[model samples]
Target: MTFTQLLRKENDDIFQAIFNHPFVDGIGKGNVPDKAIAHYIKADFEYLNAFMRIYGTAISKSAKREDIQFFNEQIRFVLNSEIHPHHNFCDHIGVGYEELQGYALPPTADHYMKHMMYHAHMGGLGETISALLPCPWTYWEIGQELMTKYEPSADHPFYQWISFYADESTGEITEEMRNRLDNIAEEASVEEQKHIKEAFRKSCQLELSFWEMAYTCEKWPGKEKVNS
Candidate 1:
């Protein structure tokens, strides 16, 4: 099996939990609370900003022009294309896309962002790809699964969101990422491969936490102190 496939197999339980999570299920059924969906979109807006920076970090570490271009294309895709779903969600809820940019990163998002950033800064291309793969990979899987299960129509409440991730183009992009990681693994040292596995596993766990965070609109434990 491909290394990416093996990683998915190892983390199958987490993937299943994400699939069965109420927040994801609600998206499939089109019954998720507006508040919860809004929380998720806002936090994800922040997350995507950080994601772009991590890609930039990867570009800096890349030796090959093709690798640099690959990261650049992904950054452009995220900036220009991937966020269409966010806009669709915002329009559904009567919020401006720009407004989401002002939202704070919730605790789970903060941790997840830091995790990716840490790997991007501290590791080589393989580790960086490992840290980054789970977000798009899992989302693609979720979208594909939801589409199969619900066969949502265009009029479905979350159809745009669902279809965005489930698009054939999205699958292609994620497959490219998997291929890149596998190629990197072939050159990775034994210790580096272990680190790559850990990074992938941790990112999977964070992906799960992100869904639960959105489900509950998770917040800090106490009120913020006043500057006064």
Candidate 2:
């Protein structure tokens, strides 16, 4: 089996939890609260900023032009294409997309971004890719599942959000990422392979937490205080 397939199979339980999460269920039914949707839009907009930085780190470590271009292209996709869903959500909720840029990363998002950045800065290409893979890969899976279950019409409140991730383009890009991770794994040291597996699993777990975070509109505990 391909490394990516193996990762998915091993983590099937986590994927199932994500699939069954109430947040995802709400999106499928077009009934999620506006507050929850707004929270997600703000958190994810900040999260994408860190996602692009991880890709930038990968590009800096790349030796081959093809690898560099691959990372570069995905960065462009996140900036230009993946962001459309955020804009749509903002528009639906009557919030300005630009305002979301000033929001702080919620607790779960902050930890997830730190996890990704650590791997990008401290690990090899294989490890970095493994760490980054779950975000897009699982989104593609979630998108496919939502589309199959709901077949949302154009007038559905979340139709644009759902259709954006379910698109052929999203699947194609996700496939490209998986293939690249598999190729990188082929030459990875045995120890590195272990790290790769751990990274992939941890990232998958974090993806599930992200859904819960949005569902609850998670935030840092307690208010900040100024010294007297």
Candidate 3:
């Protein structure tokens, strides 16, 4: 089987678990409000920013010397070319530097995010890979499904957002994560099967609600700023 096929097969159980989730459920053809979906995506960007920071840290430290150089080069490009330009999803939803600095969400949520960063920084890439598996895959599944089922209207803000993270470029990140996953599976002496599943589920739930909350806030005037 090809890498994509193999990945799908091995990760089938985990994907099936998410297949029943509300976030993925709503992405199907339905009467869902576009604003609601957009909000959730915006909230997700906040989480993404936090997540990127953590993953960026791990990628920095855990990479081999050559990989570290490559990692730095990639990051420099991401920061300079993508984020610095403010041309990605964050800008689409008004999540500028000011907003991100003052954005409020659960402290516990921050902790959930921080754990991955800490793992990467301390335990190296393997532990970090285990810590960081759930969100992107879940988001990719949702994006792929939504794009397949519903055409985004011209007014849809999330079209750009979804496409930005769901493109082939994201494959670069996935490849890195999978490489780390291989090392993790090989190295870990005692892995917790239940926690791995639970962490993914909890992260998905958090992600779904993140979208739900953002949609709720976006529908209200003078409420563009989201706080916990």
Candidate 4:
């Protein structure tokens, strides 16, 4: 089995929990509170920004020219395609860029982004790639399963978001990235492979935290809520 496939199989419980999470199920039915969805989108925007930087750092750390090109293309997709339409969606739902940008990241958000960035900045190419793999792969897996259950309408609030992952094209991209990760694994030393797998597992756990965070609209610790 491919490393990613093994990771998925061994971590099936986490994936199931994430896929079954109310945050995801709600999106599938288009019934999540706008407040919750808005919070997720805002946090996701910041996460994507961090992803771009982490991806760029991966490109710099790569020894393979093809991997560099792949990173460049993926980064372009994030900037050119993934993010702008998201901004439009947020605009439609009353999430302003300034509001999103100025808001502090939730604890889960802060921890997850740091997790990816650590591998990107401090580890080798294998660690970087593995650290980054879970998000897109898990999203694609979720989208495919959700699409089987729900056909989104054009006016559906999250239609574009769902489509972004459900697109036939995205599966190819996810598979290609996974293959690259496997290749990186094949080339890695035993110690590096150990670190890479640990990174992948940690990212998967963080992904679950992300969904729960959105579900609860979790925020960092702060002043106690004032009773109205």
**Winning candidate number (TM-score):** 1
User: What's model 1's TM-score?
Assistant: 0.96
Error of 4 at 99 (Å): 3.7
Q: Give Cα distance to truth, residue 180, candidate 2, Å.
A: 1.1
lDDT, candidate 2, 91-174, per-residue tens:
888888887675888889999999998988889988899889999888888888999999999998889988998988888877
TM-score of each: 0.96, 0.95, 0.60, 0.90
lDDT of 3: 0.52
Best by lDDT: 1
Model 2 stretches astray by more than 4 angstroms: 224-228
Query: So what's the TM-score on candidate 2?
Result: 0.95
lDDT of each residue in 1-228, candidate 4, tens digit only: 887788778778888988899988877887777677777877888898899999899888878898889999999988787775466457666767567664567889999999999888889888898889888888888888777788877787777777878887778778888898888787788898889889999999999999889778898677855455
Q: Per lDDT, what order, best first?
A: 1, 2, 4, 3
Mark the 10 consecutive residues where model 1 has the least summed lDDT: 219-228
Error of 1 at 141 (Å): 0.6
| Model 1: per-residue Cα lDDT over 118-201, one tens digit each | 989888889999999999999999999999999999999889999999999998888988999999998889999999999999
- The CA lDDT at 145 in model 2 is 93
- In order of TM-score, best first, we have 1, 2, 4, 3
Predictions: Cα RMSD each: 1.4, 1.8, 6.1, 3.2
lDDT of each: 0.91, 0.89, 0.52, 0.83
